[model samples]
Target chain A: MRAVLDEVRFLAFDVFGTVVDWRSSIARAAEPFLTGHGIEVDPLVFADEWRSRYQPSMEAVRTGVRPWVPLERLNRESLETVLARHGVDFGAVTGDELAELNRAWTRLDPWPDSVVGLTRLQRRFPIGPLSNGSIAGMLALARFGGLPWNVILGAEIAHNYKPMPQTYLRSVEAVGLRPDQVAMVAAHNADLRAARAVGLRTVFVARPLEFGPGQTADLTAEDDWDLVTGSITEVADLLGC
Target chain B: MRAVLDEVRFLAFDVFGTVVDWRSSIARAAEPFLTGHGIEVDPLVFADEWRSRYQPSMEAVRTGVRPWVPLERLNRESLETVLARHGVDFGAVTGDELAELNRAWTRLDPWPDSVVGLTRLQRRFPIGPLSNGSIAGMLALARFGGLPWNVILGAEIAHNYKPMPQTYLRSVEAVGLRPDQVAMVAAHNADLRAARAVGLRTVFVARPLEFGPGQTADLTAEDDWDLVTGSITEVADLLGC
Candidate 1:
């Protein structure tokens, strides 16, 4: 931890499942929107399907199979597909309404310790979200959830999504910090590994409930992270900020 | 103003002169850094020269004379040149120290009415700075001045500085609003003209003290702006939001 403090100047966060309870938040947001039309569907199943489509949709842009679209558009496209599969018709959902519902991703509830931990860490180092989400989406989430980020940065600025070196590099450059001076904090092993590969410090904060009840992975740190803590609060305590 | 209020969903602001007192802020920040070093340069002159270099430096990038560089880097390079010309030697200024000094742009003091005006406008529109400053720089200004911005959009994201259509378009796109749905509120006629060319609504808020007395321009609407108000508060009152 002292080693981390010595080198890390910026703390970049991974927003979705790492800092926020996306599964629960998405389910909660979608329930009312879905049930309002008398559409009877399992909200959890709907959320899982929504999450499932995220990667492939991003991959389409990453692989150049589709043009770069904002996360809101991609989410809406995926939502429509998922609802259609559940026998829900698009005739009831206008484009504007669908766009608003798709923005549910922007209002996810942070983990109980997330905001408090980030606020503490921010006192010592510049802290902001470094995620695959669009800057607009992240900003909306910050405003809605009161996430006190010094700045909001994401893949939209880099034109490349997470696990990509450009995504991490673009964030570091945006803050005028060297790669080695920025630390990537996340619950995802892949994200931390990518960040480390690009010469950034890494801190692992385990979110055991990240994947819901059936979660089997990411329950503990899988690699030698510079700092490992049970929660963002523990990480903040370890950092002594 | 009523016509604009009915359609405007986003408001992009110019940072330095429009929302903040840049000359005073820059002079104040540079004073302590330069004192007792046998470098008795006029802080006001330093501030003016520093700002004077901004447009030309950005023009170098815009015209392809220089590669794309963040505003912080541009500020550093220009600062070094300007200080050398002023016969001030700062052999003691380390790279880190110089970088921190460059961030003075981020911590500028807001205009007396900026905070109150922006707060009222934020209730009705998604308000943020649309400037040539970097995201980190704008975020710092917002935090230090208590500016309530829903997002911070800058040239770093657009890769083009203002007076360019991309700057205005990018701000609108970042907020998921069309050009016509956004309003560009600024003290500069050129900025408003650029925004107007792109179909954005425009409002001119006079900043008589922007140039610190003997100001010759931007004291009144130059073009047929959608709304002209004596101050940002007046603009807010006119918008009724």
Candidate 2:
């Protein structure tokens, strides 16, 4: 805690798996929609499949194989593909329905410690979500989860996704803080590595359930982060907040 | 009030005068700095002069007289000009000092009713500050004033100044709402008029002391805004929230 309090000023959090239980949220929300259409599918498998499309979709945009598209659009496209692969054809989904489905990302349930931990951290430092989601997405998620962020920041502001230096830098810029003054908090080693490479501090909070029961990776810290905490609340306590 | 409620799904607010009392906040903060330097100037006049530079600086960008510069840079440039005009040149003032002075915009005091009013409004509609300030500026102000904005939309995002249709439209787009579904709530008549011209709903909240005791303008509604009230709290009550 003293170590973190000594160096970190602003705490920038990765929104998806780090702060919110995205897999469960999506699975829960999609279950009703899928079941309502008389489709039989394993909700967890569906959640994992949906999340599996995320990296490839982002890679497509980054590699210029696809034009720059928002995460909502990518989610919808990938959702359709996943549903089709499962031998379930809901005919065609309307744009409005697609939009509502895409918003499942915004309605994610926060990990139990997220709200209380972030609220504690917010008392001492500027806190914001640094995610690949759009500003609108982060804002909605924050409102839904009561994730007391001082600001919403994401790829939409930078027009670049994470592991990209610009995404982290844009969050720092938005908070009017120097890169060194901001700390990136995430459960993923790659995110912390990227943040550290750009001179920002990093905190590792283990999210063992991020990928669910069969998760094999990101269960332990892979790099030397500024601080290691079991939960966001632990991070807040360590930071003396 | 009913008319505004019927069409408005989002409420965009003007920050400086509508949401926060910049004149008082700036004057209060600047007084200590000025006094420490043995520079006794009319703090109110100095604050007004500082604010008086805002629109023109933005106009310089809007009219293509200057390239798009962040609000911080614009404020710094205007501060130098204003200081020079006041004949109080502090040759020893460092860049850091000027930077701090520029950030006075971010620490403005909110009206007593702002937090409660905005929180109430946020229950039903997306609420944010749509100002000529930068995203960082708005975020910092929100933190300092405890303004409960769901999002921060500023000229930095729009790349344009108020009274321009793009400013209003960009804010609406950022919130994923149609123009008519958004309401521009401002103390300034010109802002509401511009927003209304772009097919947005409008609300006029009169800030009688915005310009201090001798000021004559913005004491009453100039246009037939969808809603008019003496305070933002009143406006919130009228909205039935």
Candidate 3:
């Protein structure tokens, strides 16, 4: 396993639910907006509701149902849809106000193990996010969370989201590695499956609470992944970093 | 100047000869090879000879004489050509050794003012290289130099070289900014002129010693730039970071 793993030179992460606790971060960031708008609802549920729309929105662009748009724009549209569904007042929210509210995705908090794991991993290999987030979105999140990414890769560069072959293939080339030299690190199985189909190594890190305490999806390794670990720090350990 | 620069959300640097003292760094990296092989060529001249071919090589790709190749591959090819012209024996150098030596660009030392200036500027905006260097090349240089870039941008993503319209246009979009919202910071007047032609604000941070103490080009701003400064630190100060 060590010999096989030694071939990997770049580790691209799935940012949102993988490196950062997006649910809590979104809930935390949205709390003020909810209060300002005089809406009464559980922030965590609101966060889940907003996140539930994430993939479908990206799918629209991926399938050509919509044009290529930055994740920030998609996030805003999703947020607006969620706000409307929740019957939240939109009368007082100005463009700037809504823009600030939309930045909830940018201010996400990194998982406790993220910094140390990534730092250790980066010492041996370049580590960065291969996320659905916009380049600006990833930049803001890195700045906010103090993520030590050597580079940012994913959506904006490929103009497509993952599970798509374009994103996977372009990511490998972007990092100056062939498909075999890169690994996709994620808490999601579907992402790993797609990356594996494109010839990338895969490491699945379990995040049972990614969607909140009651979360059940991606709770464990779903296949014989390259390396399945309980945390990213364990991933560092397994990678011999 | 302050008011105009204050609106810029990202600062994209030209890496070679701008942030790093490339001539010295490359010369230094080549010395052991020169000695070990009993070659007596001046390492500095070798560095110049290698760099002299830089644009012509890119021009081939840009003009479709060659397929899109990463800057690293171009560097190695240029190095091989220079080595052959200098009558250096390469039969003794293994493939791995040549590859390792090609990474000289990745280990360049930052100029005296580079880190301080970039660090200060990063406090106010996202900063990264918008160089012709490959993504892996930039990542290695950033890790070696402790550059605090929020992202890597440039030729690799654009699939075009600088002074080309695609590189400048794509760099802005990669950073999720409009043309006017991003600033192109470089030492070369031609670089700034190209950037400005595409509506990006330009700042010339003169590095007269970039080619060596006897450097003749870009010693002063060739035209009225958006801002002209003696050092990157001065650029940061003028930007009010």
Task: Give the winner by lDDT.
Answer: 3
Q: DockQ scores for all the models shown? A: 0.45, 0.58, 0.62
Point out the worst 10-residue segment of candidate 2 chain A by lDDT: A1-10
Candidate 1 vs. true structure, TM-score:
0.86
lDDT tens string, model 2, B4-116?
A: 45867778899889989999999987887777666668888889998898888888888878877778888888998988786776686777777888789889989999998
What is model 3's native contact fraction?
0.63
Per residue, candidate 2 scores C-alpha lDDT tens digits across A1-241 of 5454466668889989999999999999888777776667888888999999988878876666767666777888898888788776566556666667778988999999999999899988878888888777887788788877776776777777887888888778877778888889999999999999998988999999899988999999997788888899999888878
Give the per-residue lDDT digits (tens) of candidate 1, residues B83-187: 788676676667777777788988899888899998898776668888999887787677689887767785877888888788788778877778888888899
Per-residue lDDT of candidate 3, residues B1-241 (tens digit) = 5577767888999989889999999999998988888778899988888899998889988887888899999999998888888686677777787788898989999999999999999888889899999888898898889787889999987888998988999989877789889899999999999999998989999998888889899999999888999888999888877
Instruction: Report clash pairs, candidate 1.
Output: none
Instruction: Evaluate all candidate structures by whole-model CA lDDT and list the values in order.
Output: 0.83, 0.84, 0.88
lDDT at position B17, candidate 2: 93
What TM-score, to 2 decimals, does candidate 2 have?
0.94
Candidate 2: which stretches are off by over 4 Å? A2-5, A90-96, B36-40
What is the iRMS for every candidate structure?
Answer: 2.4, 1.7, 1.4
Regions of model 1 farther than 4 Å from truth: A32-41, A63-67, A80-101, A119-125, B29-41, B80-103, B116-125, B143-146, B230-241
